[model samples]
Target chain A: MANADRIAGSDVFRPNLTGRHATGRFWQTAFLGATTVGILGLILLMLNIVNNAFGLVAYADGEDYLKYSPIPVEQLATSDLVVLLTNELSTGAINKLNAEQPLDTRSRSDLLALVFERILDREVVASSTLAEAVFNRQAFEADALAKNPDARFVFKSWVTTDFLTVPMSSQALFAGVRTAILGSLMLIGLTIAIALPIGTGAAIYLQEYADKSLINRIIETNIYNLAGVPSIVYGMLGLAVFVRVLEPLTSGAMFGATDTNGRTILSAALTMALLVLPVIIVNAQEALKAVPDSLRQAAYGVGATRWQTIWHHVLPQAIPGVLTGSILAVSRAIGETAPLIVIGASTFITADPSGPFSGFTALPIQIYNWTVQPQAEFRNLAGAAILVLLVLLLTLNASAIILRNRLSARRAN
Target chain B: MTQALSSLPVTDPQDRHVDWAARLRRKPRPVETVVQGLLFLCGAISILTTLGILLVLGNESLAFFTDPEVNVFEFFTGTHWQPQTGDFGVWPLVNATLMTSAIAMVVAMPLGIFAAIYLSEYAAPRAKAILKPTLEILAGIPTVVFGFFALTFITPLLRSIFGEDTVQIYNNASAGLVMGLMIVPLIASMSEDALSAVPRTLREGAYGLGATKLETTVQVVLPAALSGLVAAFIIGVSRAVGETMIVAIAAGATSQLTFNPFEAAETITGHIARISGGDLSYGSLDYTSLFALALTLFVITLGLNLVSRWLVNRFREQYD
Candidate 1:
């Protein structure tokens, strides 16, 4: 008994005591390092984006404008800016602009954008990445002035209210994510509309109706596999089926379509719906399965049919779960650009998506297009767009999480 | 099955004759049959979607192979890929795809496993709740954002560290690094589920044998959860392979069959995106080749997913 007691307490009984302890400590530190990396990466990513979104930019007005304007470009009001464009731009240029949309009919802001883009040809002469603009503003300003003596510097937050409202422009200063945001919203709405019912129905059938048969099992396996398929593959399907084969329907040609030859919001939305359907089905099935067998039996004991029991009891309980899952899936769909690119989502579109059949460009696609541009200012624009995208994603996810928690708490009570 | 059927009201022959209304009421409802049929139709649509994907891919891929310009033998054996120039070689794109995925796996696999271990074995409940959601938020960030981050932030940082000569402006390494960060949440969460699924009894036994927390976690728990860890790894690989935006935007769209991580190289997805984004005429060889590349990607991801599912099922049966 003494020996046993000694063995329990002794280092000898703890085989490889020093060795295991040392290794364990090493691993613990390693694990800590690994975990910290994720947090650090997130911090770095946010900082990087925020830094680019707000900074000092030096803008050089068109050399021709400098010749005509008595005052510096920065001091000019919106009205003066438009007047300057009319006087400075050649008659042919004005005619071309008028042909697209008459200057007089254009909104004040839109005319201003045109002035900056076509007449003034505003260019970012020199810019700093996020950090330099923040920490060494004097140095950045001096550098910008030296590079372009005529240019004016201003402190700007790229993600302003105006940035959210304006349409795309060749000029970095005038370009905005308005059209992209509208397209994304429309696409997401359509995706949810199409995917929700079918995914939920499939899940209900799998969990509540189907028995453990070979066919059911195969269906289950197929869904699991579908979820794993590369999203780009789905893009191919959309291109073929929705964009080409069913072009008349997708493009609304069958319903008096005018401009589009497929590659419409409807096609993109259907593709996204297909992309997210497996996720919804799998998640909905899990939520359905979580509903107790006892609950179903109790309903049956009261002479409720399977459909009635599911519709009245199981579905209500599972709604929150299904909703939360669908939100995350939609978030995934919103972020998806590759498949959209494959199916011919426009890289640059100024007009907001008017309807499901309208040609579109989403936030992710806009961000992608901007990132590829050689100009440094577009990167800043991409950063601002990224912030918008992140906000939209977080809001959706948070709402879903809150709803799920509340529902579950109520159920427990 | 009988137990499920037993709940419906039953009618005796004598009773039915005396009360015809009761007998008619006892019959199965038409609404039930209609609803079941509708639900079954819904389930069948998923199968149909898969078939559509396969048929679309297979049909176009066949067209691509049959095109005289697209040499099937050369597609696999050749090293260069220039669809416009009619080079038609696919291995260069394949190599780049592998290289990027390899770098991503290297970064994500160990970091993710260690993070999962820490979360499962060491993190406090509050910490777990906070950290898990935080990780999920990371996952929720759009891939486009990551692509931009890779381009503006990661690439510049890498250039500063390694000097301008080694790190090109649009290098695969930077893209791969950001892609890894994008995938870390996926790997960690899946791995956490696997690690947490390890039975407490096994852990306790290890402790009883005078093992330290680290020893039990590393040796006993990890081994017990090996299949799950493997599944997580496979899933990670699939995600890395399927990723598009990061490579398309940040990584170079130029195709080269080089092993260097810092060099500009195009991936299969990137190649397809670049070509497809342009105005390619319908029925062009370039158009069909896009489908061929997509088919390859689909098959690879599909195979990985199946293996992952099989492994998960195998381990689950053992434990249950």
Candidate 2:
């Protein structure tokens, strides 16, 4: 200690601490800039979506049917709404609607929507982005008025309850994501059903059953490679195997639908299942590996067979972990686009997919389709659809994450 | 369960232990045998998927290359890629893919590394708790959403900044920039793991010498995790190359060999999506060309992944 104290004297070489501390603080702030960039990217992405989703829309013609009605639009009864629609709509249009479904039988909201749909042919002539509407509304309105003197400018959110339930129309204002959302749900449900069991089985085989053989090694290594393969390649595989080689099965020819080809929900679902298989297997294997050796030893010590040990002890404990993996797989499958596009998602599908044999279009596919259209309103439609898709993914993921946290908390206990 | 157990045919209690041991030693029950076979089949399915991809791509690509209309030498060496005009140079598509990936790396590399350093070296526990899941959600967002941002948000902003003549409505810059954002979480998370895995003793040694936190982190820790960081970088580049939707949506359909980010050009993935999305006949030359492009993509990404895995394994051995 005396030698160190002597070395610390003014005669010895000195180190600069204050400057070094300043440098450290600067670097720390600089590192925080990284998080700031991430934050800005996220905020910008949301802002872009919001900018397109809600804006001032210039309608070329009547959306003022509310002024004609004596009651406030929201307070109008179903019969009153029907009467308003009857007064404004052509008898032919009313008859066609009645034939589709009686107006009296429709919900009040539905009747009100019909009033807008039938009485007021509200064709949006011009639109300004959310930013322009918010920041430069006077200028935007003046410009819009120059183009269409009679145009009624109303701030509108393109995404609404009516927009979600109705099928897409030729009119951008009337187009909805009903078919796309349904196709996505059906595809995801079927993909999980096919993938979860197969993936879990594969993981079990690799983790528990397979011995150290060359074939097992090959299979194990093959999965790692398959997981890295571009999803478009998987789509090519699906295009060949499911849509071509197995056309009779996927096209429902065996089920007496010989008129159609193999581009159906079944083929798409099978493709998605294959695409996510590796991810599910890898995750499930990680989950299985977390099960301690003692659990298996205890089961075997009691005269249980290998399968009995797996079923009674290991699998029960592994279920939560396995479920977490399935949720990841679900998310991947939901977000995947290129493969579905490659396997040929129908661009114009509107009919509700009735069976596996039905043609399909997912939410992503719908978004892609809408975004490519040359019209500004179509671009707005795409934005609204993107919001719907994000909401769907958010709900599913939120629930799954919550469930995972709960399971982990319980385990910690 | 007791009733089922009691229903089993039983011998005397004295003989039961031997019988039980014998049963345990016996070949698995039929149900067990069937289940094992099913599992083995499931395991092999991934292998079949790989083989299936190889077969389909190879077969159609073979047909395309062998056709009298195509010269294999020209396909590789040509400079132009108008499929209808009989010029089949793949370099344009390949070039666009590389250019966009290069642009993506430019945006992602520094931000990702810095984020990793912050998360591993400087973040408080409370900060991490929020930041981690937020990053995960960002990672989990669909690339199609990113595509929308590129088209509606980025393209306009670029146009406004650079002048309308300077930026194409559908340009590589927007797609690349948004894709960079999409990949930030991947690189950050992976590199953060590499940073975290650096042994603490080394940092402490540097600190013991009165070195600053930043100096210790930059000099002592980063060099140690260099291999893992490289692996993460390679993986990120591979992901950017394979990314399809953003390019398809924002990057224009023109297949040109140019380094300019403001100009639009089709990437290999984008070209494939564009051609396939059109109403080309089932057995057309264009249809087959997609498979060949897909084969190229697969090979590139596969090679990248193999290298990354190798590096990651080597990195793990150092610490483990």
TM-score of each model, paired residue for residue: 0.92, 0.92
How do the residues A1-413 of candidate 2 rate in per-residue lDDT, one tens digit apiece?
88777765644334565667888999899888987788789888888888888888887646565466765565877777778887877889889889867988988877866665556665777877788889999998888789888887889898998889987677777789999999999999999999999999999999999999999999988888788787777888888789888999999998899678898899999999999999899999998999999999988776576889898888877878888888888888888998889888898876788879988889999999888887778888888998999899888878888888787678768
Task: Give the runs in model 2 whose Cα sits over 4 Å from its true position.
Answer: A2-15, A62-100, A107-121, A402-413, B1-23, B315-317
Model 1: per-residue lDDT, tens digit, A97-182? 78867777777667666666776678888766667777898898888889889878878889987799887877788889999999
Model 1 chain A lDDT-worst window of ten: A63-72
lDDT of 2 at A332: 86
Q: What local lDDT score does residue B207 receive in model 1, on the 0 to 100 scale? A: 90
How far does residue A210 in candidate 2 sit from its true spot (Å)? 1.9
**What is each candidate's DockQ, to 2 decimals?**
0.63, 0.68
Q: A26 in model 2: Cα distance from truth in Å?
A: 2.3
Reference contacts reproduced by model 2? 0.71
**In DockQ terms, which candidate is top?**
2
